[model samples]
Target: MKRRLLLVSNSTLHGGGYLQHFASNLTRRILFVPYALHDRDAYSKTARDKFKTLGYEVDSVHETPDPVDAVRKAEGIFIGGGNTFRLLKSLYDSKLVTEIRKRVLEDGIPYMGSSAGTNVSTISINTTNDMPIVYPPTFAAIGLVPFNINPHYLDADPNSKHMGETREQRIVQYHEEPDTPCVLGLREGSMLLVEGSKATLLGSTKARLFQRGKHTTEYEPGSDLSFLLTDAQ
Candidate 1:
């Protein structure tokens, strides 16, 4: 079975409502993973309420007795954003990583992720901007996609007074490691819609691509990104 994924950079746009940008793409009944936040109930409620307006019923994995079984029975899976490390650790602790991978890759369930959710969908969480509030057994993620992602990617502001490593510079540092995967800097309000072997850029902004030993490239909305699915580290 081919994978079906909707990887979003951010859940809420600057002026838009929660998940309002891609509400139309969501499945009818979603199994939500709210492990990223400290308060799972609040996170779950927020997701449920938001998805409800979109005509989707959301059941959080935190409320389920067996998260793995939830993944098995879910029509679609939606992972909300918070801390990437916490989310990955929870998934590892609950042993939902492999089950989710199987559900999406073999069972072909629709997988939707935002921000930190998008980070874990990639090969590893090394590209995440979140601090390590907690640690997982390994950096390895679900590997739903072949590469890594830096969601809510920001460009260097030329007028900024605060001097710090830009998002691009950090990703460039990542490429310095031997055999590191390609990184996609998904800007806010942008998303990647993957259907089988084909991946397309969606939303209003352009996504920046960073690969080892190459200059960064910018892809506009509606651009074909299928090449990324095969070019793994």
Candidate 2:
């Protein structure tokens, strides 16, 4: 079976309603995972309400007794943004990683993720910008994609006086590690749509690519990124 994924950098764009940017691409029935946020109920309700506006129905895993079972029956899965550590911990606690991997990779269910949610869809959560408020058993994620992702990526402002490292510099640091996979700096309002072995950049902005020993490259909205899928392996 071919994997179907939509990895979004951010859910809400500036001056846009929740998920309004890609509303038309979502499945009609979605199983939402709200584990990243502290208040699961409120998060679930927010997702439910927003999805409703898009003519979609959401079933939050937090409300179910068997989240693994929910994954089995879901037509599609959507994981919302928040703290990456917390979300990974919750997924570990509930043991949904393997099940979700199976559902998307083998069962061909569509998997959508935003921000922190997008972080966990990669090889590991090491590239996430979120603080480690909680620890999971490991940083290993669903590995739906071969590379890592840095969501909400921002370009360095040349005029700013801040001394902190730029997003690109931090990703460069990640490449210092031996055998680390390539990283995609997914700018806000941008997304990667993957179908089987093909991946395409979508939405309003371009994405930055960081490879271990190569020059950083920029890809536009309609650029084909299938090479990242095959080349990274």
Candidate 3:
């Protein structure tokens, strides 16, 4: 089977329920990653309640002793939004990072993530907007996507008097390293769907792509972004 992935900018849009964007596509039996949130149980429960409404059973990996086995057995994986650093650290501490990569990449199972989850699903979490609440061994991630994701991407507020580095500037700084790949600035309500080597942008919002030296590009919804899959690392 082809590797299937849904990387979402956020679980809820301005007027939508949790995971409303994926309600129609979700299937039964999904493994939920809740370590990013401060309250793992609450976060998992919220996700469980939401998915349950759609007839999907959600299980949090935090409740399992053998997370690797859990990932191997799960039909699909759904990681919720929160702090990227915390999420990566939890995956490493549980030693399930490699197992997840294997199941989602080598094994070709369906996987989904939102916010911080989206951050870790990419090459690295270096582009995440969240502060480093805690430390992970490294910023490296699953590399499921060739580029990094900057979730909740914001454009410069022209009306604001507070002058700080714009989101664009920060991402450009992240790419200062000669080898960093492009960064996807996913606005709220935007998502990327990947099946095998193909990727497509979804939702009504436009997304920004930041590359080195070149001007950022805004991709319309339903645009074919499969080219990103083959981008050089």
Best-fitting candidate, scored by lDDT: 2
Candidate 2 lDDT, 167-202, residue by residue in tens = 888999989999999999999988898989999898
lDDT of 1 by residue, 8-92 (tens): 8994313124344434464578899999999999888988887786678999999999988888899898898999999999999
TM-score of candidate 1 against the unseen true structure: 0.93
Model 1, residue 16: displacement in angstroms? Answer: 9.3
Each candidate structure's TM-score, on Cα atoms with residue i matched to residue i, is 0.93, 0.93, 0.93
What lDDT is obtained when candidate 1 is compared to the true structure? 0.87
Name the regions of candidate 2 deviating beyond 4 angstroms.
Answer: 11-27, 231-233
| Runs in model 3 lying further than 4 Å from the true structure | 11-26
As a whole number from 0 to 100, the lDDT of residue 106 in candidate 1 is 97
* Poorest 10 consecutive residues by lDDT, candidate 2: 12-21
| Models sorted by lDDT, best on top | 2, 1, 3
Task: Kindly give the stretch of ten consecutive residues in candidate 3 with the minimal lDDT sum.
Answer: 11-20
| TM-score of model 2 (CA atoms) | 0.93
Span of ten consecutive residues with least summed lDDT in model 1? 12-21
Clashes, model 2: 0
